[model samples]
Target chain A: MATVEYRNITKRFESFEVMRDLSLSIADGEFAVLLGASGCGKTTLLRMTAGLETVTAGDLLIDGLRVNEVPPRDRDIAMVFQNYALYPTMTVAENIAFSLEIRRVPKAERRRRAEEAAALVGLGEHLARYPRELSGGQRQRVAMARAMVREAKVFLFDEPLSNLDAKLRAQMRFEIRQLHDRLGTTTIYVTHDQIEAMTMADKIVLMRGGTIEQVGTPDELYDRPVSRFAADFIGSPAMNFVEGTVEANGNAPAFVAEGIHLALPVSLTVAPGSPVVCGIRPPDLVLNADGSIEGRLVLAEKTGPDVQLHLSVAGQDFIATASRDAAVEAGGLVRLSVAPDKLHLFDPQSGRRL
Target chain B: MTVHSASRRRLRIVAAWSVVALFVFPLYYWITTAFKNARDIFDQPPSVWAFDPTLKNFEEVFGISLGFLRQQEVLPGGGNFYMAPRLWDSIVVAFGSTVLSVTLATLAAYALSRFPFRGRHAFVAWVLSTRMMPPVAVAIPLFFIYKDVGLLDTYAGVILIHAVMNLPLAVLLMKSFFDDVPKEIDESAIIDGASRWLIFRRVVLPMAKGGIAATAVLCFIFSWTEFVFVLTLTQTGLKTVPVVSSSFVTSTGTAWGNMAALGVAAMVPAFVFILLVQKQLVRGLTLGSLKQ
Candidate 1:
């Protein structure tokens, strides 16, 4: 395992810049995730670290050694691509043993190591099978096994789990986490899926427009996102934002929209009647017996476990998660009370948290 | 009893059978004619089966004296003949040309398929344009150049011309095959510690076996039957089987029996060649190109 440092790495494709001034350090054996939407330079950053892509200008150091000019293989990094990139012509055994074979490992040792790697990924029975014969999950496991046999200093994953189904993805996610824990290899996983980042990463690096937006633990990002993008992107049924003015009545501040007013925490220091965006998680807004903010239910989606209601008030729509017992139908009036501490306030024009 | 469904099924069956019959009938005719003597060949009503079959044609051609000794007919009466040395020369030239052309073209094709460089589109267009020209158009100029360069009446001249003529087609076909190999595989190999050459040999070439076989079959067939270039470029020393077969067509008594024997002999190598790579040919033709 090794620590990787990307210092002011910038990548340009002709005139368009894919990544710019990106700098971050992944500590030894840390499960770090680079998270962003598609075309947001997460994959580009990962490839740059793998030395598969040239850095237009910057320094990439692995284990405190400058490897800016070192090729991927010499840098001792193994990458599991999104499609798995298993050699379709090779069987499971050969696919896993390819890196070792290139490194000139003896036949007996290669076979022994390949079988062990296959068993680690629960693929011991599939040594003779070709990649085409394996299912999607099995193919992904073979890709992981291929990387494992290399025993490289750094492991890079470029959205490896995005191709599997929901259940299989979750299952594989656990297997990958367990494997990482067992192997203790420094891993850099890139994914656009927030859930994968949240569930898999020890430290999550949120990126937007080729720059690091925020870097923190999953809880830290969820609890206190530095920007509106982070707050909205980090959660499912994302935090609803209402554009309104913040009104301070003595010590308590209230956020006023067209037809609703939500009280804010005393920690928010916005001037009276200053334009602000109020952020609230769907689950945090409780459907109470008596409450202040009122709206008519626009739509409700029942997920069997819980029902999510889309409440429309004052030209803004708010999402509220409630139990299945609360049968709020469309066009029905609903009242929700917001806990003041759970509320997030942002500057309206800049989207920066206040 | 839907009229549309019934008619569509009927149309499809008719179209499919028509294609099969169109291809099968010519080969059936060639095989039957290969067995016939001079009179049986031009029978007003062509017979599908030979009334009397004989192995006289094969024996006569194989036993023809090169006039080194007193002329002795290998059969009761002379039917066909071939000088052993010249027949071997034709085989050598055809196989040599195919091997050289296909190997060089494979390298060129791989480069065109992978690299993004300046003037790439122009280079591809230029290669394709070479194939558009009629072989006969360059025949006169090539003959003169070969004579001036002391390449006249030699196997080297014939092989070089064949390689040049077939290079465009081979490059186009092999390039399409190489394009089907994913660029991601190359990148993955690079990250796994493989150099560019290593990636080509270990990853790209193995995947392109089907296409390589298909290209080899096509190049062999083209060089095997190429008459115009062999006729014009080389006079005495480098004549191929096609030119030799055409020599049997004299103005006086036509040597139909000898021609049929020679035709059969020429067809054997091509038949064996196709049989060896028939799987690739069927797949290549049906698929239009390799799957990516």
Candidate 2:
């Protein structure tokens, strides 16, 4: 396993800078995920590490060695492309054994290792099948097997499960985590899906507009996001945001918006009369009889285990999740309270967390 | 409803057959004329079915007069009707040029498909523009060059020119085939520790087999039928079928039967080549329509 470091890396496409002065250090054997929306430079970052794209400025180091000019073959890294990229003409065993064959491994040993890799992916029976003959999930497994058999110092995955169906995507996500756990190979996986990052990453590097917005554990990102974008991106049903002014109410801070006044944590400090955006996760909002905030429920959707409430509060839309057993109705007035600690405060002008 | 649909299907079949027959009519007439005597060929109102078929034309064109058969009277120029060596020359030049052109085009095309060099579009346009020059215009300059190089009537000279003539079309066709292959495959191969050429040979080339076969067939057919360069550059040392067929038009009159005989014989090699690659040709034609 190897640690990958990008020191002040910047990528520009003919003056249109895609990644700007980005620095990240991935620990050896760490499953680091580069997570962001499309055009956020997450894939570009992964491709840089894979040696498919050149770093326009600064240095890229693998295991503390400067590898700026190293070709992909010399980088000792294996990549699983989004399309699975299996050689269409090669059978599953041959595909898995390609790296070994390139190294001029003995035929008997190549076959043995290929079968072992295939069995690791639960594809032992598919050894003789070509990629075109396999289904999407099977082809994905073949690509994984191909990467695994290389036993490289680093593994790069470029949105590898994005093409699979929802059910298959979840299954493969879990399998990938399990594979990483077993191998402990340094991996950098790029994806726009927050759930995959949350469930699989040891550290999630959230990116926006070609720069790092937050790099932390999933819980840290969800609980203490550095920016409003991070707060909005991490949680399902999305975090609710209310534009308001922070005011002093007998030393305890209060967030006041149109037709609403919510108490802030006593220890929280912000300048009085300063505009800020307050964020609260869906599950943290509780419905109580004597809650401080009142809103008219606009829609209620029961998604299996939870009922999602879309409420209109102070002329702004907010979402809150409750148990499936919760009795909520559309067009009904409801009182909601947020736990003070769960509330996130951000500067209104810059969207930076305060 | 059943009767109406069945009749509609029958009508479609008839229309398809009529179209195919329309195309095959000229070839049928040409082949039949190769076996007819001069009297039968110019019969009043034309004899479409009934004719005294003869092998005299073939015997003259092939320089083979069969034993135990009454030999037909030869033309005034007697031995000039013998064209077997010219037929051999056509086969050699076609096969040689096809092999040469396909190899060069495939390599050039793979580079064009993968590499992002400056002015790549302009380079491709320049390569294609070489073909825009009219054959007559190119043949005169080529004749002088061939004479200077002492390649005036050599097989190598003809093959080289034909290969050069076919390069533009071959390269364009092969490049499209390479483009149909996803670039990810090459990247994946690179990450697997294979070099650029290894990835091309083992992965990209195998996938583009159908396209290569199709390109080779087209090159072969074009070389087989080329006329201008062969006529302008060569003497009697070597002659292709298209140029040699003109020799039949002596000072007296055009020897139509002998020319038709040569034309009919020339079609066999090209037809056999197409038949051999017919499966790949169909597949290559529709290659880019489906995503792998």
Candidate 3:
């Protein structure tokens, strides 16, 4: 296991800059995920760490050694690609033993270690099968076994589970996390799926436009987002935003929109009448008989355990997850209550939390 | 299923057979001519069938008549009709050229496929453009060069020209085949501690094996049938089947039977090569499609 650090990494393709001044650190044995949408340079960052892509203007360190000029073969890392990339010409056993073969490991020992890695991924019975003969999940397992057999210093995953089905994705997520816990290899997984980031990362590095938006524990990002983008990107059903202005109701601060009013905490010292945006998560809003915030119900979507209440408050669309038993109608008034401090205030112009 | 559809299907089957017959009739006539006597070859209303078959032409061309059949005469080009050494020359030239062309093309094509060099597309187009020139124009210049180098009538001289002639087409085909294999497999191998050369040899090359076989077959066929370079460059030291086939048309009445006999004999090696790699030719075309 080794620490991976990117210092002032910049990437450009013929002057079209994809990243600028991007820096982050992944600690030894830490499962840090690079989370972002497509074309956000998350994959590029992961590739640079893997030595597949060059860092245009930065120093990349593995175990504190500068690797900007190192070739990928000498970097002591293993990767699982988005498509599983199992060598089509080889059987599972041969694919797993490829690293050992390249390093001149003994034939008997290579077979033994290959079997061990295959057993770890539940692919022991498929050692002789070619990749084309296997199902998607089995092919993914072979890919994992290939990576695991190397016992390299770092493990990089480029959205390895993105090609699997929904149910298989969840299972692979749990298995991958368990494997990391057991081996404790420094891993940098790039993915666009927030659920994978939140569920598997010890540290989630949320990137936007090639810059680090936030880097912290998943809970830290979800519980106390530092920006409006972070709050919306990290949650299910997304955070609801209602544009308005801050006003003072006596000593208590309140967010006043066109047809709605939300009381804010007294300690929120926004210049009494400045423009602001109020954000709250769907689950944080409770359906009650008495509430200070009122909205017109647009639609009620039932998702078995809970219903996502689609409401229009102050002519702004919002969603609140309420229990299925809550009496809600499509075209009726819905009163939603939220703790005063549960609401987040952001600067309307910069989208920064206030 | 329906009456009209059944009749239409029958009509299509007949049409396909007619086209196939148009293709195969040359082979049928050539093989029959190899066994026909000289008079029968030039018979009025040329004998498609019912002609008495003889091994006299084969004996005249191969210089080896079975004891049962022994009717022969002086060859039009020379005193004796022995031409086995010429067939040997053709074999060496075609096989040697195929090996040389395939080896050079594979390495060049791999670099073309993977490297991000400036003007790469233009370079590929330039390579293909060399093939558009008429072979005779290149052949005359090559003859003068071979004379200076003292390579005329040598197997190496002929093999070199054939290989050079085949290179442009071979490289283009091999490049397309290399492009079919996914680039991710190479990256995965590299990250697993494999050097670039190792990834190419152990991984990518095997994946493109079928494509290589297909390419080798094409090169072999081209070298086998080539005519102008051999005719322009060689004196009496060596001659390939195509050039030597013309020798049968000297002062004597055209030896159609002898020429047809050589044609029939020449088809064996090329036919055997196709039979050997036909499976790979089919597989290579479809190999890269499954991965992604």
Candidate 4:
């Protein structure tokens, strides 16, 4: 296992910069995820680490050695691509044994190691099958076996579960995490799905516009997002934002919007009339008859054990989740309450958290 | 519903067979002329049937005197009608040139498919443009070059010219085949600690086997049927079937029977090559349409 470091890395394609001055440090045996939307350059960063794409500016260190000019072969990293990228012409056994073969391991040893890796991925019976003969999830397992056989310094995954069906994707996600836990290899996984990041990442590096917005543990990002983007991006049903001006009512601070008034914490030091965006997560918003804010319920969706309500509060849309037994209906009036400590305040002008 | 569809399919089959028959008529007439004697070949209204078959034309073409064969007067070119050696020459040149061209084209096409260099599109276009020039335009200049290099009338000379003539088409065909292979395989191989050459040989090349076989067949056929370069470059030392067939057109009259005999014999090697790779040829043509 190795630690990965990106120091001021920048990538540009003829002045159109995809990644700009990005830096990150992945600890040894850490499963760090690069999470973002499409075109957010998470895949580019992963590729740069794999030497598939050049860093364009800064140094990339693997195990504390600068690997800026090292080719992928010499870098000693194995990647599982989004398409699985299994060799179509090769059998599953050959595909797993390929890296060992290239390293000049003996034929008997190669076959032994291939079988071991295949069994690790539950593919022992499919050693002779070609990639096209397998289902999408099976192909993904073959890709995992190929990477596992390498026993490389780092394992890179570029949306490895994207092609599988939803149920399969969830199943494979747990399997991948278990494999990572067992192997303890430094892995950098790039994915747009926040659930994958939240569930699998030891450290989630939330990215937007080619730069890291926040890099923290899953709980850290969920409980304390540093910006409005992170707050909205990291949770199910997303975080709710209500725009209002902060007012100092003597020693107490209150947020006043069009038709909502919510009390802020006393320690929040903001100008009396400055505009701020108050963020509250969906689950933190409770329906209470004695609440300070009222909204019209637009819709209610029952998903499993929780019910999600889409509401329009203070001229802004918000989503709040309650228990399945909560009495909620579309087009009904509801009073929502958020604890003062659970409120996240950001500047209305810059979107940075205060 | 089944009956309507079955009748439509039957009508389609009839139309397809009619078109096939229209295309095969010339080859049918030519093969039949190979078995016809000079008298029947010159008969008015061209005997389609009821002509007496003779082995005399085959005997003359192959220089083999079967006990039942009727011998004819030897032609004026000192029995050059013995075309077995010429047939051998055609096979050697066509096979040699196909091997040469396919090897070179595969390497060049792989580079074109993978590496992104400046002017790569223009380079491919230029390679294709080389095929647009008429062979006659190049034949004279190549004749002098071959003469200076002491390569005239040599098998090597003819093979080299034919390989060069087929290179553009071979490269274009091979490039499309290489393009069908995903680039991820190459990157994966590299990450698997394989060198670039190893990836090409062990990964990409094997995946492209069907395509290469298809390309080789096309190159072999083009080299087999090529006329101008072989005619202008070779003399008595060597001649392919296409050029040697011209020698049958003499001062007195054209030996249509002898020419037809040579033409029929030449089709066998090419036909055999195509048959060997017919499965791969069909599959290779329709590749890249489906994701694996």
Best by lDDT: 2
Answer with 1 or 2, whichever has the higher DockQ: 2
* lDDT of residue A84 for candidate 2: 83
Q: Score chain B of each candidate by TM-score.
A: 0.81, 0.93, 0.91, 0.90
Q: Write the per-residue lDDT of candidate 2 for residues A1-354, one digit (tens) a residue.
A: 999999999999888999999999999999999999999999999888888889999899999999989999999999998988788778889999999999999999999999999999999999998777788888899999999999999999999988889999999999999999999999999999999999999999999999999999999998899999999999898999889899998898998899778888999879889999999898998998788889899999989989999999878898889889887788999998987888899998899999
Give stretches of model 1 more than 4 Å off.
B1-18, B48-90, B253-257, B279-292
* Model 4 chain B: worst 10 consecutive residues (lDDT sum): B283-292
Best by DockQ: 3
Model number with the top TM-score: 2
Window of ten residues with lowest summed lDDT in model 4 chain A: A81-90
Q: What is the TM-score of chain A in candidate 1?
A: 0.97
**Poorest lDDT segment (10 consecutive residues) of candidate 3 chain B:** B283-292
Question: How does the DockQ of candidate 4 come out?
Answer: 0.45
Of the pair 2 and 4, which is ahead by lDDT?
2
Model 4 C-alpha RMSD to native: 2.6
Models ranked on TM-score: 2, 3, 4, 1
Interface RMSD of each: 5.3, 3.6, 2.6, 3.4
Per-residue lDDT tens digits for candidate 3, residues A1-354, read 899998999998878999999988899999999999899999999898888888899899999999999999888889999988788888899999998998999999999999999999999999998888888888888898999999989999999988889999999999999999999999999999999999999999999998999999999999888899988899999999888899997898888888778888889889989999889999999987788778899999999999999998877888999999998889999888889889988898898899
lDDT of 3: 0.89
- lDDT values, one for every candidate: 0.84, 0.90, 0.89, 0.89
